[model samples]
Target: KNEGSYTIGKVELEIKLVNRGHVSGNVKGGNFFKASGFADMFGNASKDYQPQTLIETPILAENLKPGESRRFRVVFDYPPYFKGVTQFTRIFAH
Candidate 1:
């Protein structure tokens, strides 16, 4: 929840994986959403201005007003059928 008096700045999504090829997912920011940009963990670290996200629809939200909260949904599939494969997943909102 946005507990401040002023609106929050832009929002970004980040997905990280330690050992894996690639994973796909979906994210939606309700109705009042605007996809400003998308980036992978590496792209974000390297400060690359490119859309390399795995989110199916990386719909970024508009101004997150004060004391207002928005809903988001994330759906992803498990790693392929394998054995002894570890996948470290992390999702962050910036």
Candidate 2:
């Protein structure tokens, strides 16, 4: 299981979305154990804030157990274009 899920910062923007993973359950379902995240655009936290994006990692595991955590690589379908320019150029890439 290499491909994981997405975890973004705190902000809200309307962008095209791609189906990532469905996270549900308290015990049996796999809640995100660990996940990498980013913002829709590149910019400083003061100028541009990160918003929560959906997870897009493919689940290779056949079954999810309780207390089990999954990893996901979250990405947005479209780039975060705010105002007039793209915001990612200034964001620190992980």
Best by TM-score: 1
Kindly list the per-residue Cα lDDT of model 1 for residues 1-94, writing each as its tens digit: 6767887665445443222222223323342223354534345566433332233334355588888887776555434422122333433344
Using Cα atoms with residue i matched to residue i, what is each candidate's TM-score against the true structure? 0.40, 0.20
- Tens digits of per-residue lDDT, candidate 2, 1-94, equal 2123533222222332322232332223343223244334442365645333333333223343433444534344543432121223121112
Candidate lDDT values, in order? 0.44, 0.32
- Pairs of residues at least 3 apart in sequence or in different chains that clash in candidate 1: none
Off by over 4 Å in 2: 1-62, 79-94
